[model samples]
Target: MKKNQEIKKSLAEILELPKDIVLDIPKITMVGNLQLYIENHKGILEYSNTRIRINTKSGVLRVIGKNLLLKSIVVEEMVIVGEIHQVEFTD
Candidate 1:
């Protein structure tokens, strides 16, 4: 496999996620601090600003915070910053 593909595979294995799930794309953008329906959304370990949750097909981006500011939001792109209180994901 190529380097990027290998990396993605490694991440999927590390995350214990199914390959299909790990490759799912986001449908919605900037629900909150979260990117919706993002499958291979790795590399986020610290979420002190705002809580975020994305949905399948990248349809929804849910964010929870005291005062949130979404700098930009698109169907598959988003940015959020603010005082975050809690973050969770729902199925």
Candidate 2:
């Protein structure tokens, strides 16, 4: 697995490609404190008004804040919008 990752990393660097895409990892983007987008997600593990936990290739992505709403969700991506305060990853 480590060797495969190393190869992928080298390939990404050589081709000027995104590592996240090459490694099949989640890509997270945030805009101020209003919204967040999680790409390449596995699935949503938990959801509530204040928190949302998304499963990914790396780990469980925990989003914490107020008025957390799942604005959109799909097979490969998800969109979260609210007063996002913190984002973390856990095993």
Candidate 3:
């Protein structure tokens, strides 16, 4: 698996392709501390007013903050809105 990942990374760099798309990884985007956009996620693991855990291809993405809300969810992406304080990943 690691070898395959390395090959994909090399190919993406050599071809000037987007790594997230090439590697099938989650693309995380934040708008200030109020909103977050996660693309290519597997699913939502846990959610609450103060915390959210999302399943991604690489690992579990944990979002911590206040007044958290799942603003949007689709097959390929999710939008989280609130006062985001921290984000972490764990395998």
> Which numbered prediction scores highest in TM-score against the true structure?
3
Model 1 residue 70 CA deviation (Å) reads 1.5
Per residue, candidate 1 scores C-alpha lDDT tens digits across 36-77 of 323333223234344555444323445567555545555545
Write down the lDDT of every candidate, Cα atoms only.
0.50, 0.93, 0.97
After best superposition, candidate 1 residue 40: deviation in angstroms? Answer: 8.5
Off by over 4 Å in 2: none
Point out the higher-scoring one by TM-score: 1 or 3.
Answer: 3
What are the runs in model 3 whose C-alpha is more than 4 Å off? none
Task: Please provide, for model 2 over 1-91, each residue's C-alpha lDDT reduced to its tens digit, 9 standing for 90 to 100.
Answer: 8899889989999999988889999999999999999999999899998999999989999999999988988998889999999999999
Candidates 1 and 2, the one with greater TM-score: 2
* Cα TM-score per model: 0.39, 0.91, 0.95
Error in Å for residue 13 of model 3: 0.9
Pairs that clash in candidate 2: none
State the lDDT at 37 in candidate 3. 99
What is the C-alpha lDDT profile of model 3 across 1-91, one tens digit per residue?
9999999999999999999999999999999999999999999989999999999988999999999999999999999999999999988
Off by over 4 Å in 1: 1-22, 25-54, 57-62
Model 3 clashes, total count: 0
